[model samples]
Target: MNALPRRRPNPLSCLAGSLLLTAMVSSAAQAAPSQQLIDAAKQEGMLTTIALPHSWCGYGEVIAGFEKKYGIKVNELNPNAGSGDELQAIKANKGNTGPQAPDVIDVGLSFGPVAKQDGLLQPYKVSTWDSIPDDAKDAEGYWYGDYYGVLAMGVNRDIYPESPQSFADLNASEYTNGVALAGDPRTGNSVMMTVYAAGIANGGKAGADALNAGIAYFKQLKDKGILVPVNGTAQNIAQGTTPIYFDWDYNLLAMRDKLDGNPPIDVVVPSDAVVAGVYVQGISAYAPHPNAAKLWMEYLYSDEGQLGWLKGYCHPIRFNDMVERDVVPQALLDRLPPAENYRKAIFPTLKAQSEAKTAVADNWAREMGVQ
Candidate 1:
């Protein structure tokens, strides 16, 4: 979310504004799916999807759940690929009816409009379309946000008694040679967002200027030997090699529980700046199984599907709506980090994120004078 203003209306506040809207839309949205659509989807039998990592967003179970519900097979492709690769897949397989072609894509929000402009995407609004915030989706249903996550500090509590509450805390001499990114900023969304979030904390805004300032800040960390070059991982954090890692809140919290006290880590959404990053979903214009792709969209925006993402710690686009309606289970809400942190989170526009991504890629290493 290197959220420009960060998309937030606490669960309670959302009700005051959304309750009327929700009531107006509920009747139409609750209508059952026409048998014709289901029949067509069944006839297609398969839906090819791309760039969905099982561990990243509880996708392993999501896929299994979808398959179980529909008897349709989901053929996953290049689970580790990026948003750019997802677009390339659509371009390269335009006329191909093979399994290699993706029926649907879940990519960075920025790529949605570009894909639409490129004529690579098809439009299909889900049953719960109104629940998706207008700003997070296109007017024509070309693409819509599925879920979002905020970046946070993952501190190995075994090494440090307290977590760093803000970016400035990283400068503490005790944190020397301890900080690292979840992955390389030049190549990864989460990594680039970490830089963007740091820049905001350092007083830069949500666009390119903030990105350049972020790059400069990282250079300072490097010069002081405070920010190490290695990519952060659960195993390395457990090993205490990357004691202070900047990464998504969901990952750090998940890893903390998985580690089970061997190395307790504090996943702190820094007090100074909170950035929300959202990923969007779209169907391929040339999809071999158009009905199936549309069916997948319907399922994803449904309560079951949204909950699947929420289970994985992601904030589903319909989360506040569900919260207002009391549909989210208390146990699930209990598992997440504080809601107050998300209140202050900024959700940067796709333009801001695109500019930030480019700035980080073009200047991160060059500005630091690193080869």
Candidate 2:
């Protein structure tokens, strides 16, 4: 599968390398974009933008499609710049430039609030806004998650003939020191979601007692010298330098295709528990073309827009619509955890997420020197 275009790159190159996930098709009950939003976006003529962090390679297809459909022009910026830098670039260029700033911003869930608080983000809910679940979007319409990734442990069968089923299994001496840590949670957005996943596996807020279990899980792997740190690809795992990895389900699944043999890789959303971590997108408060930015969001969440995500392997946020249309492969659908299980998947409310942010950072610093 092709890589989706990344919005911006961060300095934490190492941690950014390992996380992955795929598309989601939201419900038709969810709001669909209005013809007006679509028409206005086209009139804007050009859509200039930036997407934070980077991931698979198919995003260009989405951008290209939107431009093709609307006859609007889109210029996606580089993927190597961090969100901080990308935001600064827009702030720095305020009012003077013709391009102004990006029409949209895609980022990790945690950072969405941070950007909102920083007064960096603008709010505009697409006409089809009602379709988004409350938890998936801001009430004020500042941002909404287009898709998400569930945390899953991936084993490089080449390195470990035996696959790991749970975090407890991962901590076992047999697999100890063989797993690769995704890198510092502080610098990488996806890994931050991993930390939150660890929280869910340990037991949400009630899992405070088990938080140590989560910490010890990583500690054991680290102390065993079995845990290897890698970014997005499975190069280390495939080469047998690292036998196990924990990453976004979509990422691990996608990476397996790059290997030569079956490679004995298994990625499972821990039945032990899971978290609904998200990658979000929203219109820039100062978008060069606000209408186009709103249109982009509408397109992304629409049936056509979400299909690209499924084709690319990111689990679509809205599955009911996609499955009916057969946008995703039945074979792929079979690989996913049950939909009801998704409801069981923990997604921290914004307040809960804010708390996790500091706690995750502080704990990582104290426990793994990650911050």
Candidate 3:
């Protein structure tokens, strides 16, 4: 009789309970990432790698900030590989590489085309795309420049107390046997770009023919025995081994911090003939973490990201809004000589660059005897 009294089972109630349990398990499985996971990898903390040839221009700060914000550590490798070497490394490790291909690359403007042609770049239309100057990036979205450096003279004050003020001054007899260069046209893209820049500083495309003047300028220095084929190096500038060197303004500003006493170095943005050359960044086509890479690209071109260059004495290619909002500090701005100095900086079209390169090499060999 007691057993029969307990047999008041509700079939509907048991079915409802079964359905509720199933629903609860499904919801648990589909639950969104917790704050912790989001903190660890906003999109995905997978991993990001960059090939940065330039020394850390306070980039460490940028990395630290990004890591803290996204909960992902950024791995930056500044291999000594120049433009050629960097490309080769990527090509060599294309398939059998690590988790990510060189996710990001920073090279001279000339390398952008080289990389693009090799099919090494991934295209992404960044949020800041419109802000970038038309001439500074690929309209199709292959690469974008985050910072730029002007072709200027790096003068060692200890050696050349009276630093040359213009490119014209550099060619004077006094600078003979004193001006240093990394390489002639043989393997130096910077040298080549500088020649092109000189042409622009002299007069944009109309100035294209004027690049010959750069070779002539070098010829004078070589004749005076002042042309010391010393590539840009601290040893050359610090020991007064070579009093003058031609390079992007960033290097000169950087040397000020790299060498002890920096030897009272002076960087001049030749008001008359300075050309601005850009350092470009691109995402690898085979990026393992394409999503993360895209996000990183966006961050780099953002107001916060580009302004980080100020810490390294590099100028932001975009983010003029930050300057307008005073988001960047004055001290950092001071490190940059002046944007107007680059107003006349020449940027050759891709087609013109091809012609210009050959022209520069031929002229340098005959005039500067670089060969």
- What digit string (tens of lDDT, one per residue) describes model 3 on residues 1-371? 01123233221111211110010111112122235434434565554565553454456666676677666657555444455556665686678446535667777676787789899987877765655655567878888767766667778887788888876666666776678775554345567766665554445453337566556555666787878877756668778777777776766777777775658888787766645556778877776556666666666766677777767777666534455445677777776665556555544445555565667756777776545
Q: Pick the candidate with the highest lDDT.
A: 1
Those runs of model 1 whose alpha carbons end farther than 4 Å from true positions after fitting are 1-25, 28-32, 369-371
Model 2 residue 211 lDDT? 41
Top candidate, metric TM-score? 1
lDDT of the candidates, in the order given: 0.81, 0.61, 0.62
Question: On residues 1-371, what C-alpha lDDT tens digit does candidate 1 reach at each position?
Answer: 11123344432111212211111224323444567888899999999999887777788888999999888999999987777788999999998999999999998777888899999999888888766777778989999988888889888998998788999888878888899987677656777888998898898977787788788888888889998878788888889889889877876777777788888888899888877788899999999999999988888888888899888888887776777767789999898776677767677777788788788778887887766
For model 3 the TM-score comes to 0.75
Q: Candidates sorted by lDDT, descending order?
A: 1, 3, 2
